[model samples]
Target: MTTFDDRENAFENKFARDEEFQFKVTARRNKLVGLWAAEKMGLTPEEADAYAKSVVQADFEEAGDEDVIRKLLGDITSAGVETDDAAIRAALDAKLVEARRQFIEEA
Candidate 1:
């Protein structure tokens, strides 16, 4: 193969790897955030696990984090838990950091 072709292939591979890494990180963050919210809502252990999975699936509803945030916020309020958007957003940020750290450690 030509040098240019080889370089193009390498770039494509790198892009794929990066996309996969991002997907993992986002899913991890969603799970962490879901657990946190579940605890705040006082869900049972089994319920929390299912809730976390649902939170991870929420991301698929849209192209960005808004869908997950909306789901958590709505659920929290509907469950009569006392929380605001600021707190949820803060949790999301913290969980993202934790998720990235965990993923790096695992790698």
Candidate 2:
């Protein structure tokens, strides 16, 4: 293949890898955040695991993190937890950092 074609292919591969990496990181973050919320809601260990999976699934509902945030907000409130959007957003940010750290450690 021509040099230009090879460079294009390399870029495409890099883009795909980056997208996959981001997806994994976001999913991990969602799971972590879900567990955190579950603890706040006073869920049992088994229930927390299922709730975390549900939080990851919630992300697939929309293009952004709003879906997960909405689910957490609704559930936490329904469970009688006093929380706000800012708190949830902060948890997301913190868990994202933790997720990235876990990935780095694994690597």
* Candidate 1 deviant stretches above 4 angstroms: none
Among these predictions, the greatest lDDT belongs to: 2
Please list all clashing residue pairs in model 2, or write none if there are none: none
lDDT of each: 0.97, 0.99
Off by over 4 Å in 2: none
In terms of TM-score, the best-performing candidate is: 2
Give the lDDT of residue 101 in candidate 2: 97
